[model samples]
Target: MNQLNVCLSPALIPLYNVEDHIVVIIDIFRATSSICYGIENGAEAIIPVSLVEECAAYREKGLDYLLAAERDGKVVEGFDFGNSPFSYTKEKVAGKTVVLTTTNGTHALHLSRAAKKIVIGSFLNLTSMCDWLKLQNDNILLVCAGWKNNFNLEDTLFAGAVVEQLKTGDFKPDDAAIAANDLYQLGKHDLNEYLKKTSHSERLKKLGIEKDIEFCLQVDLITAIPVLDGEMLVKLQ
Candidate 1:
């Protein structure tokens, strides 16, 4: 049986042997959820860059990349859009390559480069993500992109949701995975209400982007699974 572990924050990734595991990068407040929705809506690919400058550099590559940059819960100045899933409509992203950098999600992707395989995870594609994961032979590592390297609730709750799904399979859960599953069970009934007091939720509320929170919490709206292929995320074929 493959073992399943959850790393609650990107800062703790170094403690895990990622090279031998399939890493699921979770940033449910926005990034991964947006990736899933964009790909499902016909995005050609998404290029996750660690820095805003790196995302900008893709513009000069002549690929007509759509640049999406986010910082501190808002769209960066001079970018096409931020990390909101609503911004990734079919009319906008269809057959286009998006170069994206977010405050936490892209940073977590960079930190997880050594993993055997890296896939984006979010509530948007929860069932499909777990279905694909169960078919893989590699051990699984759920890496949460917490708020600025500090643990956050939304990502951890999503990780816990994944753990709940995978635990019924031929996978053994680590302590973190166990904790996440428990947390998910506690919050699954009413996610929006359950997260009302979380720091990230409060932060987004103050930014007046509460709708993004409601959207990200929707389960299995997308069937696409975005997997990292070299430097880009493409829908799993």
Candidate 2:
């Protein structure tokens, strides 16, 4: 049987060996969602770095890449853009490479380098992500890029959404996975409404980006699966 599990936070990442499993990294607030949007909008690739300086270094090298850096729910100073799904439009990001860094998502991506394959997951591409996972034979680990290494609701809910879809497959989910699935079941009906009171949601709302929140919660908006190929993320066609 195929084993499925959820790592609630990156702090628990050391507990698993991503080398042999198919790892799906979830950061629903924006990072992963923005990545999915960017790829689907025709961005060449996204290079995820864990630090703002690293993302800036790409500009120092005179690279033709858009620098997107966010920390504590806001855009980093000097960054060309923030981690907002709406920022990555076809007209702006098409044929451009994006170098991104975020508080939780990019850190999780750096930590998940050992995975056999790393997939970016968010509600925007929920269906496509699950579709890709169903075809893989390896064990599946949903690694939630929880806020600052602490548990967050949005990413956990996304893990559950994926688990709910994989129930018919040969998946044997662990306790954490089961918990996430239950959460998803509860919020799947009205994700935007259910997550409105979440810490991350409230934080983003304070910044007046609720539209991005609504957009990120919409399912199946895109069919692209952003898979990490070495240092950059590319759409898996």
Candidate 3:
């Protein structure tokens, strides 16, 4: 039987035995959600860079890719897009490659390199990600790319959602998983409304991107599971 665990932030990743677990990176406020949208919309692949310069260098080398870098909840200057689901429409990202860097999400992905497999998780592709997890039969570790190594509500809720879905499986959840499940139980009724008061929600709302928040909370908007293949994330078809 597999077990389910949760790490509220990447800072706590080292506390767990991640090398043998399937790490599902959750950044529901935007990053992972945007990645889900991009892949479902037919983006060729998403290369997650940890630094703005690294993302820009992909373009400097004349590689035909969209440069998406965000810091402090705003799009980094000179990038093609920010970490917003709306920017990844089928018409825009189809057949295109994206080099992505964000404040937390990409960092979490990089830190989780020791995992047996890295799967991107967001509410946008909730069910599909769960399906993939069921097939793996590996211990699950939901890694939340919280706000700069601090805990955040949205990611934990997403983690809780995953745990809630896997409740029937042969799994033993850790304390973090139990906490996340409690959070999910509290917010599962109306995710958008439940998360309205969260810091990240307020941060994006201040920027007038509430639409992205709503879209990010949507369940099963797509059926793609973004998995890290080498250095890039490609849809697990």
Candidate 4:
């Protein structure tokens, strides 16, 4: 059986053999969720950059790229928007390209670039992502984009959810994956209530973006899985 491993935080990524595994980057609070929404809404592609400046450079190239940057849970000034799924409506993003940088999510994507293949994951695309993952031949690494290299509850919970689904497939869960699956079993009944006190949730609550939280927690709302192609995340076709 292919082994399924969960790296609880990006800081733990160096310990994993990413190049031999298919990496699913999870940032359920916003980034990966937003990616799923944008791609489903028909955004041509989303480029994930680690630095805000790198996202900005795309603007100078004179392409009509929509730039998005977020830091500490708030949209950075001078960008079109941050990592909010609602901002990626079909009316807005259809046929456009988005250049994005976020405090946690994009950074995790950068760290996992050496993976055999990289895909974005969120509760929004949970079922679709797992269904596709079950058909893959490589070992799987679910890399959570925890808050600033430190473990956080929401991301871990999402990793656990994936573990719960994939456990019945051709995958064998490692210790971390087992722990995550257990966590998911405990919290799957009411995700919003389960995450009420999480650090990232509190941070976003303070910013008054509770809608983003509610939307991100919804299961399988989006069927598109955003897979990395070169530096861009496009809907798996």
Candidate 1: stretches off by over 4 Å: none
lDDT per residue as tens, model 4, 1-237: 798999998989999989999999998878889999999999999998778899889989999999998776677888998888889999989999999887688778878989999999999989898989989866999999987899888888999998888888888888989988888888899999988877566567777889988999999998999999998999998
Q: Tell me how far the alpha carbon of residue 58 in candidate 4 is from the true structure, in angstroms, after superposition.
A: 1.4
Question: How well is each residue in 127-226 modelled by candidate 1, as lDDT tens digits?
Answer: 9999999899669999999988999888889999998888889998999999998989999999999999786566688777889889999999989999
Judging by lDDT against the true structure, name the best candidate.
1
Question: Positional deviation of 90 in candidate 1, in angstroms?
Answer: 0.7
What TM-score, over all chains together, does every model reach? Answer: 0.96, 0.95, 0.95, 0.95
Q: For model 1, what is the error of residue 104's alpha carbon versus the real structure, in angstroms, after optimal superposition?
A: 1.5
What lDDT is reached at residue 99 by model 3?
A: 90
TM-score (C-alpha, index-matched) for candidate 4: 0.95
lDDT, candidate 3, 1-237, per-residue tens? 788999999999888888989999998878899999999999999998778998888877887899998776688888898888888999989999999887688778878899999989999899988988988888999999998899999999999999999978888999999999999999999998898888666567778778888889999989998899999899887
Which parts of model 3 have CA positions greater than 4 angstroms off? 71-74
lDDT of 2 at 124: 86
What's each prediction's clash count? 0, 0, 0, 0
Local distance difference test, candidate 1: 0.90
* lDDT, model 2, position 14: 88
Model 1 weakest 10-residue run by lDDT? 199-208
